[model samples]
Target chain A: DVKVTQSSRYLVKRTGEKVFLECVQDMDHENMFWYRQDPGLGLRLIYFSYDVKMKEKGDIPEGYSVSREKKERFSLILESASTNQTSMYLCASSPGQGVVGELFFGEGSRLTVL
Target chain B: GESVGLHLPTLSVQEGDNSIINCAYSNSASDYFIWYKQESGKGPQFIIDIRSNMDKRQGQRVTVLLNKTVKHLSLQIAATQPGDSAVYFCADGNQGGKLIFGQGTELSVKP
Candidate 1:
C-alpha cells in the first residue's frame, strides 16, 4: 500500500499571512502534484514536480508556489493568503516510468483564509 | 486550454442498485484516462483506469468504459453501497503524465 502523508488536515490563516502545506510520499514516486479543489470547479492543478528540485507551473499557479527540496517531500507555499485562496488542497504522487500511472493521494488539507 | 467536464453534477441511487457517472474530455490527444472517488474531507482515491487502446476495464465492483469517438467516459458501480457515495472525477492525460481533471459528479447512495 502506498502512503502519502500531509502535515495538516485543517488550517486557518489571516489575510496577507504566509502559509505552507507539506506532503511526503513513501512509495518513492517521481511525480508529485498539488491541486486545489473547489465546489463545482473540481481539482485544478497548482504545481507539479517531476524530480527533486524540479517544478512546473500547472493551470492555476498564480498566488501559489511549490518546492521539492528532496525526493520524498513536496511543499506548497501561499506567499500571501487571501479569502479567495481558501480551498481543499491535495497532494499526489505517481511512478515516473509508467505510461499511464495512477496517482496515490494524501488526505487533503482544508485551508480557510480569513 | 483543454477541458474535461461532467454531464451531471449529482446523482442519487438506492442501495443495491447500479449507478453510472459520465464525463467528457475535449482533448483528443489524451491517451489515458482514470476514474477517482473522493469522500468528504478526503483526497481523491483511484478507482479504475482505461487507456485509449482499450475501451473498457473492470475492477472489484466498478467498471470504466471509454468512448474515444465521442470523447466520453463512464464509470458504473454495481450494487451500490453507502460507502460508494462520493464525488467521482475523470481525468485525461497525455503521454507526459499531466492530468486534466473533470468537474466531479457527486453520488448519493440512499438506503
Candidate 2:
C-alpha cells in the first residue's frame, strides 16, 4: 500500500508567523498536491507539483507556496500566517496519466493560526 | 466556471439501511470522477472511482453511478454500519489533472 506521511498532525502559530508543512510519499508518484479543507468550503487545492522543481498554483494559492525539491518530498509554506488561514491541510500524490486521478492522501495537519 | 457540488449536505440513516449520496458537476468535459470518505481530523480517503465512459462501478459494499448527460453522480452504500458514518465528497478530474471537490455530504448512521 502507498503511504503519504505528514510531518505534523497538529500545529498552532501566531499571526504573521511563517509556517512550513512537510509531506512525503513512499511511492514514486509523479504528481503531488496540497489542499486545505474547510467546513462548508470543502477541499480547495492550494498547489500541485508534477515533478521536481516544478509547481503550479491551484484555485486558492494566495499566501501559500510549495516546494518539490525531490521526488518523494513536497512542502507547503505559509509566508505570513493569519487567523483566517486556520484550517486542515492535506497532502496527496498520484501516478500521473494512467491513474485516473486516484490520490493517496496523508493524515491532514490541522493548523490553528492565532 | 467548472465546479463540483453535492445536492444534500447531510444524510442520516439507520444501521442495516441503504444510503445514497448525490453529487452534481458542471464540467461536461471531465473524464474522471472519484468518491472520497473523510473522517474527522483525517484527510479524504479514496472510496471508488469511475471513468466517463463507464456508467456504473461497484466496490465492497459501495457503488458509484455516473450520468454524463446530466452531469450527475451518486454513491450507494449497502447495509450501512456505524463505521460508514463520515463526510463523503465527490471530485472531478479534468483533462489537465486538476481535481475539483464537492462540498461533501455528512453521513450519520444511527444504531
Candidate 3:
C-alpha cells in the first residue's frame, strides 16, 4: 500500500505567520500534489511537482508555494497565513511513469489561522 | 473552462439499499474519470477509476458507469452500509495528468 505521511495532523497559527507542511511518500512516486479542501468548493489544487526541483502552479496558488527537494518529500509553504487560509490540507502522490492522475493521499493536515 | 460538477449535493439512503451519485463534466478532452470517498477529518481515498474507452467498470461492491455522449459519470454502491456514508467526489482527468474534481456529494445512510 502507498503511504503518504504528513508532518502535522493539526496546526494553529497566527495571522501573517509563515507555515510549513511536509509530506513524504514511501512509494517513491515522482508526481506529488498539494491540495486544500474546503466545504462546497471541494479539493482545489494548490501546487504539484512532477520531479525534484520542479513545481507547477495549480488553480489556486496565490498564497502558497511548494518544494520538492527530494524524490520522497514535498513541502507546502504558506508565505503568510491568513484567516482564509484556514482549511484542510492534503498531500497526494502518483507514479509519473504511466499513471493517469490516480493519486494516493496522506491523512491530511487541518490548519487554523487565527 | 473545464469544470466538473455533481447533480446532487446530498443523498440519503437506508442501510442495505443501493445508492447512486451522479456527476457531469464539461471537457470533452478528458479521457479519465475517478471516484473518491472522503470521511470526516480524512483525506479523499480513491474508490474507482475508468477510462474513456470503457463504458462500465465494477469493483467489489461498487460500479462506475460512464456516458461519453453526455459527458456524465455515475457511481453505484451496492448494499450501502453505514461505513459507506461519506462525501463522494468525481474527478475528470486526461493523459496529461491534470485532474478537475467535482464539488462532491455527501452520502448519509440511515439505519
Candidate 4:
C-alpha cells in the first residue's frame, strides 16, 4: 500500500505569519499536488509539481507556492497567512505520464489562522 | 467555465440499503471521471474511476456510471454500511490530468 505522510495534522497561526506544510510519499510517483478543501467549495487545486524543482500553478495559487526538491517530498508554503486562508490542506501524489486519475492522498492538515 | 457539482448535498440511508450519489459536470471535454471518499479528518481516497467512453464500471460494492449525453455521473454503493458514511466527491479529469471536483455529497448510513 502507498502511504502519503503529512507533517502536521493541525496547526494554528496568526495573521501575517508564514506557514509551511510538508508532504512525503513512499511510492516513486512523479506527480504531486496540493489542494485546499473547504465546506461548500469542495477541493480546489493550489499547486502541482510534475518533477523535481518543477511546479505549476493551479486554479487558486495566489498567496501560495510549492517546492519539490526531491522525488519523495513536496512542500506548500503560505507566504503570508490570513484569516481567509484558514482551511484544510491536502497533499496527493500520482504516477507520472499517461491518463493518471487515481491520486493517493495524505491525511490533510487543518490550518487555522487567527 | 469548467465546473463539477453535486445534485444533493446530503443523503441518509438505512443499513443494507443501496445508495446513489449524483454529480454533474459542465465540461464536455472531460476525458475521465473519478469518485473519492473522504472520512472525517482524513483526505479523500480513490474509490473508483470510469472513462468517458464507458458508461458503467464496478469495483467491489461500488459502481460508477457516466453519461456523456447529459454530462452526468453517478456512484452507486450497494448495501450501505456504517463504514460507508463519508463525504463522496466526483471529479472530472482532462487530458492534462487536472481534476475539477464537485462539492461532495455526504452520505450518512444509519445502522
Candidate 5:
C-alpha cells in the first residue's frame, strides 16, 4: 500500500498570515500535485511538480506557490492567506513511468482563514 | 477550451438498487478517462478507468461506458449500498501528464 502523508489535518490562520502545507510520499513517485477542493468547484489543481526544483502552474495557480526540494516531499505555501482561500487542500502523487494520471492522494488538510 | 463536466450535481437512490452517474468532456483529444469517489473529509479515490480504444469496462460492481460520438461517460453501480454514498468525479487524462477533473456528483443512498 502506498501512503501519502499530509503534515496537517486542520489549520486556522488569520487573513494575512502565511500558511504552509507539507506532503510526503513513500513510493518514490516523481509527480506530485497540490489541489484545492471546494463545494461546487470540485478539485482545482494549484501546482504540480514532476521533479525536484521543477514546478508547473495548473488551472488555478493564483495566490499559491509550491516547492519540491526533495523527491518525496512537496509543499504548498500561501504567502498571505485570505478568507477566499479557506478550503480543503489535497496532495497527490503518481509514478512518472506508470499510467498517465492515476494519482494516489493524501487524506487532505482543511484550512480556515479568518 | 478543455472542460469536463457532470450532467447532475446530486443523485439519490435506494439501497440495493442501481445507480448511474454521468459526465461530459469537450476535448476530443482525451483518450483516457477515470472515475473517482470522494467521501466526506477525504481525498478522491480512483474507482475505475477506461481507455478510448474501448467503450465499456467493468470492475467488481462498477461499469464504465464511454460514448465518443457525444464525448459522454457514465458509471453504473450495481446493488448500491450505503457505503457507496459519496461524491463522484470524472477526469480526463489527455493534457500531457495532467488530469482535468469535473465538478463531481454527490451520491446519497437511502436505507
Candidate 6:
C-alpha cells in the first residue's frame, strides 16, 4: 500500500500570513499534485510536480506556489493567506509508470484563514 | 478550456441497490479516466480507472464505463453499502499526469 502524509491535518492563520503545507509519500512516486476543494466548485488543481525541482501551475494557481525539493516531498506555499483561501487542501502522488494514472491521496489539510 | 462535469450533483439510493454516477468530459484528447471517492473532510480515494482503448473495467465492487464517442464516463457500484456514501469525482488524464477533475456527485446511501 502507498502512504501519503500531510504535515498538518488542520490549521488556522490570520490574513496576510504566509503558510506552508508539506506532503510526503512513501512510494517515491514521480508525480505529485496539490488541489483545493471547495463547495459547489469541487476539487480544483493548484499545482503539480512531475519531478524534483519542477512544477507546473494548475487551473487555480493565482495565490499559491509549490516546491518539490526531494523525490518524496512536495510543499505548497501561500504567499499571503486570505479568508478566501480557507478550504480543504489535498495532496496526491502517482508512479512514473505510464500505464497507471491512478493517484494515491493523503488525508487532506483543512486550512482556515481568518 | 477543457472541462469535466457531472450530470447530477447528488444521488440517493438504498443500501442494497445499485448506484450509477455519470460524468462528462470535453477533452477529446484525454486518453485516461479515473473515478475517485471522497469522504467528508478527507482526500479523494481512487475507485477505478479505464483507458480510452477499453470501454469497461471492474474493480472490487465498482465498475467504470467509458464512451469515447460521446466523451462520457460512468461508475457503477454493485450492492451499494453505507460505506459507499461519499462524493464521487471523475477525472481525465492527458499525456502528462495532470488530471482535470469534474464537479463531484455526492452519493447518499440510505439504510
lDDT (10s digit) by residue, model 5, range B1-111: 689999999999999999999999999989999999999888889999999999999999999999999999999999999999999999999876788899999999999
lDDT of 4 by residue, B48-96 (tens): 9999879899999999988899999999999999999999999988836
Q: Write the per-residue lDDT of candidate 1 for residues B45-110, one digit (tens) a residue.
A: 999989899999999999999999999989999999999989999998773568888889999999
> Per-residue alpha-carbon lDDT of model 6 for A1-113, expressed as tens digits?
99999999999999999999999999979989899988889889899888899998889999999989999999999999999999999999999843348899999999999
Q: Write the residue-wise lDDT of candidate 3 on A66-98 in tens digits.
A: 988999999999999999999999999999743
Better of 5 and 6 by DockQ: 5
Tens digits of per-residue lDDT for model 1 on A31-58? 9999999999999999998899999888
Off by over 4 Å in 1: A97-100
lDDT values for all models: 0.92, 0.93, 0.92, 0.93, 0.94, 0.91
Q: Output per-candidate TM-scores for chain A, rounded to 2 decimals.
A: 0.96, 0.96, 0.96, 0.97, 0.97, 0.96
Native A-B contact fraction in model 6? 0.60
Judged by DockQ cut-offs, the docking class of candidate 4 is medium
- Give me the candidate number with maximum TM-score: 5
> Interface root mean square deviation of every model, in Å?
1.7, 1.9, 1.6, 1.4, 1.8, 2.1
Better of 2 and 3 by lDDT: 2
In order of appearance, the predictions have TM-scores of 0.97, 0.97, 0.97, 0.97, 0.98, 0.95
Q: Interface RMSD value for candidate 1, one decimal?
A: 1.7
Task: Give a tens-digit lDDT track for model 4, residues A1-114.
Answer: 999999999999999999999999999999999999999999999999888998988999999999999999999999999999999999999986434679999999999999
- Is candidate 4 or 5 superior in TM-score? 5
lDDT of 2 by residue, B2-107 (tens): 8999999999999999999999999888889999999877788999999988999999999999999999999999999999999999999883677889999999
Name the better of 3 and 5 by lDDT.
Answer: 5
| Model 4 clashing-pair count | 0
Give DockQ for candidates 1 onward, in order: 0.72, 0.69, 0.71, 0.75, 0.68, 0.62
Which candidate gets the maximum DockQ versus the true structure? 4
What lDDT does candidate 1 reach at residue A1?
95
Candidate 1's C-alpha lDDT?
A: 0.92
Docking level for model 1: medium
